[model samples]
Target: MIVKRITNVFFRYALRVITLLFAVSVIGFTLVSLSPVDPVQQYVLSVGSVSPEQRAELEDYWGLNDPPVERFENCLSAILHGDFGTSLLYRRPVIDVIREKFANTFALMLCAWVFSGVIGFILGCVMGANRDRAADKILKRICLLLCSVPTFWLGLLLLLLFSVWLGWFPIGFSSPIGVMNSDVTIWQQIHHLILPALTLSLLSFANVALHTRQKLIDVLESDYVLFAKARGESKRQIMKRHGYRNIIMPALTLQFASFAELFGGSVLAENVFSYPGLGSAVSAAGLNSDVPLLLGITLFSALFVFTGNMIANLLYGAIDPQIKESYANE
Candidate 1:
């Protein structure tokens, strides 16, 4: 019975993912169709002028001669067969380019995600426990300031201060210049990552910190917390036992939901820093109208976001057994 229930849950989740992906693909393709940039013309301009015959061949090659519906059908068919189509910009398979770019983006995002969560949670806890005090007031002002700053603007300022003026870090890129990719050390990559990751972290942590602070405040004022205080539990003891237990789940949910925001911010962050990541790739694809690449990225992002939410849902079962029982009944 347990196995069957788990199977049912998995099946439902799978169907939802499929439906979501299909919808994303349709919407992405429609948007691309509406875009004014002509991929073939862009390609020709990049490669210099071509004869009328050659232009016709290029249009045929990209299936620009076909009806929109037919082209979409062909694209869907290729996707089903594990081909995301070749990128007009890179002249490479969309998936292959995405894979390479996403590796760098993932590393950047992972660093930002960890730093934001850790710093935010800690700050939130401090502010919540010390409400109306200097610490809380100072942190609240900082969060508000940081939240208002744009990601790209922050990246540029950090780059100028730390890299240009202070000469503490390299200006931009994922790795050091004048070094072969194969020869670049892990530390080199990390050094380049610091500014962009910091920018993203600073921008993102505010949301988590504020959300957590409010949640902790609520939990602290609850009846059980008052009872604990009456029972002679120290402030620290009450927080350690109850405050953390109640707030952790909500914090996790917020963190996971922030993936979409993180992805969006990364675009600005990468462009500002000239980092070769999925975000930068997205910028290039859009500017050049690389439909295959753009559509592929759109679908991937949808999947990425859905997967994050799904993981959060699954974790609820592990974190709270009542949630698990509810899932089983469903």
Candidate 2:
């Protein structure tokens, strides 16, 4: 049975990845095609004044002069060979740019996700358990207020209050590279992360708290929960063994989806903070019409979201045996 479950999970995950790749390809191709300026023009414009012959030469060099189908085929071939092509603006390999900035973004995202998930789950569980109590009411009102504020506005407000007003941390970017171990303590590093991570976490926390509260409420009212209660199970035992177990599966699914949103949302937040991350990289590439960099970032982000969702689905089945049994029947 375990072997069968594992096989099923892998099969579903494989299908999800394939679907994700297809969707990403379609979206990337369509958006690029719809843009008014061609990469050749943008490339020439970036390189200063150029003669018509030079423009034609550049187009031919990059295969941009090819028919649309041929150009797409060439692009795909290059991508398959791990050649993201050169950035016209940066004059560097697209992969090099991504590699340089991806770590900061990933680290920021990791911290934000962990903080949001843990805090949101705890707050949500408490609110659900207490229902209409004062604490629940207060939490719900706070969540609603947070949700009402735009993430960009909230980030700016936090920056103003913490960095500008209080002088707590640096305004932008990751810690300087190549520091001796002694220059910055662990506490200092964490202090530097507080603003960006908090900005990102606020949005995620509101979302998770709302979803978790709703899911937990539903789970608490389910027939299984009622039966557990009727069996003279202690409230604590019922919550730990039954209520939490069931409520958490859906919450986990929502949280995974929220992580994907965090990546997308990071673009704006990163820009606001002047953070040197993938989001900022993509924004720069877009303004510069750097197709390779743009496509690479889009594909990378789509992969992250797809993989997260696939893992969530597998986890859902694992945590809930009925899900597996239903899948087996199907």
Candidate 3:
């Protein structure tokens, strides 16, 4: 019975993900089609002008003469067969480019995610535990300020302060220029990564911290906590016995749900730092009207975010048996 329930849950989420991908593909393709950028014209500018005959051949080759529905159908068919089509901007297979760019992006986001979660949770705990003390008041003000600052603006400021003024990190890019890829050590990559990751982390952690603080405070005000206080239980003791569990689940939900925001922010962060990741690639694809590349990225991103939400739900069941039983019964 338990196995069957788990299978049902998995199947349900799987179907939802499929439907979401299809919708995203349709919407992305429609938007790209409506974009004013003429991909062929952009390509021509990149490669120098071509004769009218050559231009016509290019259009026929790309199936630009076909109806939008026909073109989308053909593209969908090819994708189902494991072909993502070629990128107009990079002139490489879309899958290949995405693979390379996604690796860089994954590293940057992972660092930011970990840092944000850890720092935010710690700050939230501190603020909640201290209440209206000086420490809490100071951190709350800082979080409020950070919540208002844009990610790109933060990246720029970090760029100027750390890279330009302090000269502690590189100005930009995933690695130092002129150095062969093979010669780039792990430390070199990390050095370049610090500012971008820090920028993203700082931009991301405030919401988590603020949410966690409020949740903790609510837990502190619960009847059970008041009863414990009347029983002469110290604040620290009650927090240890009652606080962590109650607040953690909500904080976990918030943390996991941040995957999409981090992904979106990476685009602005990556572009600001000139990092060669999916964010930069997507930007180029949009600017140049690389339909296949843009659509592929859109579909992939939808799956990515959907997976995060699914994982959060699954974690909830794992961490709480009551939740699992309810799901099983459903």
Q: Score every model by TM-score.
A: 0.97, 0.90, 0.96
Q: After superposition, how far is residue 277 of candidate 1 from its true place, in Å?
A: 0.5
Error of 3 at 110 (Å): 0.4
Q: Write the per-residue lDDT of candidate 1 for residues 146-183, one digit (tens) a residue.
A: 99998988898999999999999988899998989999
The 10 consecutive residues of candidate 3 with the worst lDDT sum are 320-329
Candidate 3: what lDDT? 0.91
Q: Report the error of model 1 at residue 141, Å.
A: 0.5
Q: Look at candidate 3 and tell me the lDDT of residue 16.
A: 94
| Candidate 2, lDDT over the whole model | 0.83
Model 3 CA deviation exceeding 4 Å by range: none
**Per-residue lDDT of 1-330 in model 3, one digit per residue for the tens?**
888986888899989997888888888888878878677887788789799999999999989999999999998899889999889889999999999999999999999999999999999999999999999999999999999999999999999999999999999899999999999999999999999999989988999999999999999999999999999999889999999989899988888889899999999999999999999899989888787788889888888888888888889998977897777668
> Order the candidates by lDDT, highest first — what do you get?
1, 3, 2
Q: Let me know the TM-score candidate 2 reaches against the reference structure.
A: 0.90
lDDT: the better of candidates 1 and 2: 1
Score each candidate by Cα lDDT: 0.92, 0.83, 0.91
Local accuracy of candidate 2 as per-residue lDDT tens digits, 28-67: 9778988874788777776689999988887788776678
